[model samples]
Target: MPQTPLLSVVVAVYNGELFLAKFFACLEAQAIEGMEVIMVNDGSTDGSMAIIDAWRDRFPGMLVIEQENQGVSVARNTGLAVATGQYLSFPDIDDDFKPGMYRRLLDLALASNLDVVTCNGNYVYENNRKPSRPIFPEDKLQSTGVMSGPAWLKKALDSRKFLHVTWLNLYRHDFIREHGFKFEPGLRHQDIPWTTEVLLAAQRVQYTNERFYDYYIHSASVSHKPDTDDTLIRSARHYIKILEMLEAINQRYPEQVKNIPACNWQIAKEGLGILHTFNNMKDPQKKKMIVKEFFDRGIWRLIWKNARGFRLRWRLGRRYLKLKKATRVPG
Candidate 1:
């Protein structure tokens, strides 16, 4: 009988032929025992499948699942459904991790019996042409050692340096399954709400300052794509949805008093992102429609109610008045 692996790394691949070799090389170099890699190919039209097939021999424990182009959420959820490991991680194809990253994380998780363990990483820009910046700078994160997920989240939010990326953390499989957490299908910027909920439900969480992963920032990356009408509208709607989700989470976990401030901070930050997206929209008609929806949904009131500081509240208020004036729409 095959022994259950210690860790399962789930990867969602889409037209990733250009980076598969480097990614595979990094994985091979990890040299970690009892680890399985589950690669979900999300209907790539490129030679991504061919590259993955060729690399199969190098990674015998690797499993591949082919599915239609249903976006990353579905691909990741599909991988999670069949994963047979003690711990789970989701890493991007375009990214790489430092040596011993997973080994160290796994060791810490086992030693502490933690539900989640996270480490810091750097953002490598344009394939390292630009100097990389630490995702969580030294001053941005102060709390260390093992703490409940909600406590960790509150401290991180208080520091104003919380990140929603899932790739930076290792999660216990049972902990995730127990909570019935799954990515929201077809939602852009889904990580924001997903991570929020995960942290809220986590019982034992640990944080390390060690830099592990390299988040490559390239023009081809979805985050770097030039904003268009479609992108703006999608982002605006996504932020609104995130705010709603955060509110729901707060209501569900009412005993997590610490989560209230953290949730409010996240809501304010997402509201700013929505305002920025609205400002960048090219089509006046579309922008007006979005503005109307924002008002109709009472998102403006929500933003004002939860916005933290006076400065942020004032800024949002000013933006709201300006947006209303520009759109010439009724309140």
Candidate 2:
């Protein structure tokens, strides 16, 4: 019989002192046997590193690797390099897992012999728990959707239903390593490409309608912070690059062309959504500047494409143009 799994759970952290204890406690409570919890402290200045150090002594199998201030992707990649698990999972230090999350997810992943095994997660903030919002076209679970890597990705992308989330799944170690894949070191939205890439290689897949992850809405998360940073622009560039790469992949897998529409539509809408959320920005100058800076060649084309289909989009395009005019950026 195979030796018990040394499942490596990598928790990526950077100044996550506020939630470190709860996160580790959640790890401790996981009923999965023979697991190693690898914590990556990505140059946290806060008490986060100290907290992890304390736990290093407390948790017998815990390993801590310290690095300079790098992004979450680098930290995760570092963990991946040293991980000895038969299976791999990524967890954010600010998130928690339901009881037996590892056990249930691992069982499904191994049983299916899949490159990837995904599960649904519940969104929890404060005291509220809600179903994980689907990132795919339709929110329906195929009563355990399973597919070949290409087939599954094509369907999900066409349906606009792929969640593109990193934490909601488990992956085979060899598959990840053999593919020469790692989280993008500095890209803010690294998961989009990483998940899409791996699903392209998945031979078999599995899912359970279980909400075993507690995805917390915390301000400390880089994604939740103010968007007026290099991180946003950098991540946007990364996203665009991924799209270009996928276009090349589509040449090889002609059936996945439908993913193009879903990607472009969401990119256009979500770009606008980001601006909408910034209605709370207090400084008009900053807001105007941000709006002006956010637009690019592709975004302008997306706005134009979407505008033709919806009057609301046309109005937005007009507003966007006026902002660009006011900001006096060359068209």
Candidate 3:
């Protein structure tokens, strides 16, 4: 009889041949045992599959799934569908796991019986060869403790220090499955909304200040790409999708999301920023049409309605008026 693995590491890659060797070496150096790594090749035209196969030869039991070129969300969902471990972590091919990272996370998760256990990660720049910025300040996580999902979210939102990326947290598989948690397909910025839903559903969460993951920042990465009109438009559309996902979750668990109004405000603010980018578009007619799509959708009104307090309402109103004035176009 096969014993269930303690943790599953899911890596979703697209044209990741350049990073596979370093990433595989990082995985090999892990002090943790009883873990399985699942690699999903999302129709890479490069030699990524061959790289994965060579590693599979060296490391037995490494699962590889080949699929058509879907987006990152779809790739992640495919990996989740086949994950057999009690705990799960999603690592990007470009990122490297620090020494003992999973061992520490698994140990904390087991000791606390937590729904989620999260640690800090550092952003390593390709150009800068020095230490990177820590996700959370040292004073903020001076001690380790447990908090209800909702409580932790409130504190995290207030400070704006929450690690919204998927890889930073190790989730209990049963908890995620039971809650019906899955990333929304065909969307960028899926992690922001997915983490929002996960935090609201989590009952017990453990946190530590120790940095365990290396987030590589390079020009080629989607996040670090130049913000051209196309990129801004894509980000704007995705933020709208995320806003919708968050609204559904807020309605499902209103009590768990007392700070949702603040979240809504932040999303709306991003939408406004996206709208402003249209001003930089070369085609004036196209810019006007896209601006109308944002305003005609009544996203601003919905955000104002979501604000729960007088202060929040007043703040959002001021921001809204400013955005409207700055980006006005003839109706």
Candidate 4:
């Protein structure tokens, strides 16, 4: 057996042959010490497995595990089971980090003793597309901010200011293990529930306004695609469960913002996106019926109950969307 590592970098690989070499080239150059790379092959039929094999000699600290094709969640869970790192992080196969990122993150995590530390990532795209607005600055390893548990989530949910992905955070493995938190397996939007649970349980969370991770938005990515029926149902279920989870946390700490703020924004944001997805279908009746059924299914109540913004904005947004739709309606 190889020596124990101080940090475990979990990677869930699925058909990532194209970028594997570039990713490892960056990985091999990390300045961080005592790091182990735990990668799971979710039955990649492509040459991803072969690529890992080739790099095994150079990355002797690398731990590779292969399983039948499962969702990213399962692959992560599998990696977590055997990870010896006190701190943990995951890098999506297509994404790469700048040099010295791992060392910087680990140094901050150890020195600060924070339950979680996250930095901003630069969004890179084809033809030099970057995010319109960024929440964090470039390459900052140390971050400082106010601390709140349930109340913090309420504020983010209230203002509709939240991070959608979980990649940038360096998680304390012990904290996560104590809380018994795991990613929702075989489901879309797994990060939402996982991150929500961790944030709610955190006592000291920090942020670094740095750009260590590079989020490459390829056209084939899920966020770029239109939502299907499965996506809508999955998102609705995820919100419902996450709300229940947050409410339970609120009960324990009711003195915070949880006393009055409802989850309207989450419902509205998630549900309306689903509604917009219905438009792409060729059948008008299908779109209309799905929209009606969404309301009939009592989804709006969840949205209505949890909304944090002014009622006027909701009304205005609803009207604007209607006009946008009307422009395409057949005369």
- Which candidate's lDDT is highest? 1
Worst lDDT 10-window in candidate 3: 322-331
Show pairs that collide, candidate 2: 136-160, 136-161, 136-162, 137-159, 137-160, 137-161
Question: Residue 299 in model 3: shift from native, Å?
Answer: 1.2
Regions more than 4 Å wrong, model 4: 1-4, 129-161, 225-264, 284-297, 316-331
- Give the per-residue lDDT digits (tens) of candidate 3, residues 1-331: 8889999888889999899999999888884566788898998999999889888866668999999999889999999999999999998889878889888889889988999988887888898866788877776644359888777776666665556788889999999999878888898878878887788889899888888888988878878766766666677677766666767778888776655545655565555556466555655555556556667777666565666667756765665654565456555
Best by TM-score: 1
Residue-level lDDT of model 1, residues 1-331, one tens digit each, is: 9998999999999999999999988878778787899999999999999999999988877899999999999999999998999999998899988888889999999999999999999988885688998898878885389899899888877777777899999999999999999998888778888888898899899999899899999998887888898878888888888888887887788888444586887788888888898889878888888988988898888888888788888888789777887568543
Native-vs-model 4 lDDT? 0.69
Q: Score each candidate by Cα lDDT.
A: 0.88, 0.69, 0.78, 0.69
Off by over 4 Å in 2: 1-6, 57-59, 127-139, 154-162, 226-255, 258-264, 270-331
Specify the poorest-scoring 10-residue window by lDDT in model 2: 129-138
Q: What overall lDDT, based on C-alpha atoms, would model 1 receive against the true structure? A: 0.88
Whichever of 1 and 3 has more lDDT, that candidate is 1
Candidate 4 clash pair list: 139-210, 139-211, 140-210, 143-207, 262-306, 263-306, 264-306, 264-307
Off by over 4 Å in 3: 129-131, 141-143, 259-261, 279-282, 307-331
On the 0 to 100 scale, the lDDT of residue 213 in model 3 is 86
Give residue 137's lDDT in candidate 1 (0 to 100): 86
- Per-residue lDDT of model 2, residues 159-257, tens digit only: 545567888888889888888888876666668768766876678877676677877776566666766544444454565555544444445545544
User: Best to worst by TM-score, what's the order?
Assistant: 1, 3, 4, 2
RMSD values for the candidates in order, in angstroms, are 1.8, 4.4, 2.5, 4.9
